[model samples]
Target chain A: MTSCSGTVLLSRITAGIPHSAAYDDLPYTRGGAVDRDAVGALVQSAADGDAAAWKALVDGLSPLVWSVVRAHRLSDADAHEVYQTAWFRFAQHLDRIREPHKAGSWLASTARHECLKVIKSTRRLTPTDDPQVLDGISEDRTPEESLIESEEAAAEAERIRRMWQEFEELGDRCRELLRVLMASPPPSYQEVSGALGIAVGSIGPLRQRCLRRLRARLVARGVR
Target chain B: MNDNVGNDSFDEAAQDDALEEALRRAAAILDPVPAELRHLAVEAYALHSLRDLDARLAELTFDSLVDALPVRGADVPRMLTFSTGDLTVDIEVTAEGLTGQVLPPQPARIEILGTAQPTATGTVTADEMGRFLCDLLLTGPFALRLRTDEEVVVTEWLRV
Candidate 1:
């Protein structure tokens, strides 16, 4: 569990944050959720070609993009490229991006769009065809399965495994909705609406339904 | 009746809040963001700057991929059309490279940048007919920075 100092230093250096407690004080985190103001300011600077500011934006929003790509059940390789291409598209569109603080939503939608395109073309499915019709996204769960298998002596890990098992059993729609919401610095309803091509007003009801379903399954499995 | 409905919804809201708390922890443990992906994205920020061209580019109005007729034994070419109120750029992308034409047949210069690379991968200039061909691009993220008469316009980054 011990990583070398050099690895830690390199990560900090690439992420463009000095070794300080400043992140805690930054306005990025609010009530344990991400604050849009912090992200908006970074977008402004990053659009103006400030590399450090861009790096900050990346650190903040990459998880949301990862969530979108993973939702498609892409191969790890495609998922990796999805992360790169989504940020690339964001960079190019940065100047045109209005409501800079909502960049997380924009990035998430773009990543989802990218995933849809990749999934469609590779599977030779029509754009109008339901995504679920494309062989169910290959489920490429080897990594997740292996990680669960490797859990040793950890009660919490065991609980998470149980929760995940229940998660996998939910209907596709519920699973997809919760997966998107699981993103760190979770996206706004408007963003999720655009990304999933669902009606804006429906997301809250959808979330409630999905969450209730998940809760029922977890409780049934004795997650308590 | 309204008050009863309100109370019922409030109870549901509290339960959703608690489920959210469980989800927060579960997502963190189950699908934590991969470190390498974050590093790649941060590194990409250093690739190029879009400081000068702030004006929004045109939206894509047409695509050849729509209802594409399958051609036997040939790779599919992805064709895209983007336009502003008065300008249009049509591009056809294939494994070989990209072929594009800017409207009204005017001479122009274009820079192809791999958005994740530190520099432009290739550059091409269109003739008076407004037609240009680019070198084969790396199979990843890319953007086209075109020099118009009045200013520069960058296309949305796309997969090639």
Candidate 2:
């Protein structure tokens, strides 16, 4: 089952590339830009049985889904299950998705629902009144020392690591908002609103306020 | 003063943009989505062909985990209900296996579908009374596909 040729092709297609080349190959790439319309095309094609298009969608949107799952502070195992379930559900609902352009929003909403389900089940089993206590317990970090060949890169990595420490110090709401906002290739304000259950109109102002607070924290720590 | 305020706000926005970008780069490098998970997601698309597109999806109407209040010290089995139109499938999941009933009291064939397994892990036949039991313990994400005399139905995926 694991030896499906499609799996091999997909890994090759997504391997080491930050974004899918298939995604970049879309006609919508004016100056190598990514927008909702391009995503809509991929969705439509995948719904029509295009495997490459499906790979593109997975490569492009998985990070957004991952961010939403992580924001709930679930264990890595639980988060993995949620992430897998969300994508599987999305694959099943590909043809029925009413708004292809808003697939990111669909994914975000699904992941959020899955996260809530996991939290509820775990809370029932463990009887924890505060879910926040589950926080910081799943800090699995991948070593990137091999990637830090240059002193300059090492210094930059350290700076960002410290910035992350400050980022963690922000309030839960701010941290969650920023975490979702940091999704690579970025997600739309509509997607962010769907993921975080915030008003779409409020995202800009809330993001500004949250970032201002984070920046202040970083400045105080002399990390910047 | 108004011009200065406008410039200050613009600069703040720029700074925020830069800071967000840096954090995004760091996250990509530090806390990436596991390669295995990404592979699974990509492989999920293959299920698109495996699933009968015409099959009616049994919507998950109730899940005990999300719905029921916890009773202290009670050994609560995970209860789930999926329904579409007049049909309902109620499943009770315990550590040992699954016990479910296809409502309206009809016989059917049930196939246990796991995400990792390309094919159905096992198939059980529901009796005339609409009750079926599977002794095989389920792990990870799973779903049920029911083939009855009238139509085919697939339940929503859930993790055990």
Candidate 3:
């Protein structure tokens, strides 16, 4: 909770000047694997009128993009709408981006912000439902409650139902930790630690413990 | 216990190092990305293809998501309006598909494109007043390109 509010300091090493250069600097990939320069250059290429570069950016960042929006568990229609608009906003403001190379985080933030709009509008449409849907998200409710709510609270019991229920039984902290872990393409431990407000050094050690605890809960309940 | 955990290596170097692969896989099953998500993300990039350096939509004056006149009844068609450098196009969208007209009207060739394929996948001609309609069932992202003896005008790609 404390960690997510931390400034998402993107690698703004590139000059903030828009359209000043092609994506020549290296851009890094998910899992911290090196492609730093390639991604940087790709963004530049996209900015400088390279359609292929733009395509490459989407191809590479699709997992992150999908992950960020999918994390919200919007109805399929709303999810797609948010997805298209995220890219559309990028397309419209391509020139204004301060650091085009850090588009992964930028797009992630955009999709996350867009989720708020959709969730709010959805509330407006359904007056009889819980208005606390997502408004309480940035505030009080635990990640476990939100995850259940996000995935459609009234979903009838099924296989995944057991899994989610078992997941919820892992307690608040583990549920929050793993929720961040399951993010598409998965965020780095440092990013995860920062977002979740856990100590950076303990994230790796804690990840194993959390998953192991969840496994134990599942096994104890006779869940495969 | 696996010897890996006993090591004091809290650093990510030997940390996640694929240790959580199973959890990652299980989580995927719990919440899978729609198969079409990636394709549509890619198709969204086709809008960038319209970035031919200078040519661009002058302004997207109106869109249903924004300043659309609200419909009080059911089966209302969604609407949008865009102004390029020279011409302005007004469009109405519905479950049946898209129909539109260009301002300062004149005869022109209209191409309805499926973003899953190439641009202008299917072509139609507008009547003398620059009004054109298409019955193409849109299942994916798309763009519209209008051509005449004067020049070619293309709208940014969109999902209808």
TM-scores of chain A across the candidates, in order, are 0.71, 0.77, 0.53
CAPRI grade of model 3: incorrect
Q: Give chain B TM-scores in order.
A: 0.72, 0.90, 0.65
Per-residue CA lDDT of candidate 3, range A157-178, in tens? Answer: 1334565656645655676567
Kindly list the per-residue Cα lDDT of model 2 for residues A1-224, writing each as its tens digit. 32243344444434444542322322111122235776787777787777877887887788889889877767767888889999988887888899998999999988888888787767632221223322222243333443355677567667867777677668889988988888776678899988988999888888889999988888888888
Q: Report fnat, model 2.
A: 0.65
Candidate 2's C-alpha runs over 4 A off are A1-33, A124-147, B1-5
Q: Give per-model TM-scores.
A: 0.73, 0.84, 0.53
Decide which is better by DockQ, 1 or 2.
2
Task: Name the candidate that leads on DockQ.
Answer: 2
| Per-residue lDDT of candidate 2, residues B27-63 (tens digit) | 6655567789989999998778677867888888998
DockQ of predictions, in order shown: 0.37, 0.48, 0.11
True contacts kept of 3: 0.22
Which candidate leads in TM-score?
2
Could you tell me how far off, in angstroms, the CA of residue A31 lies in candidate 1 after the best superposition? 5.3
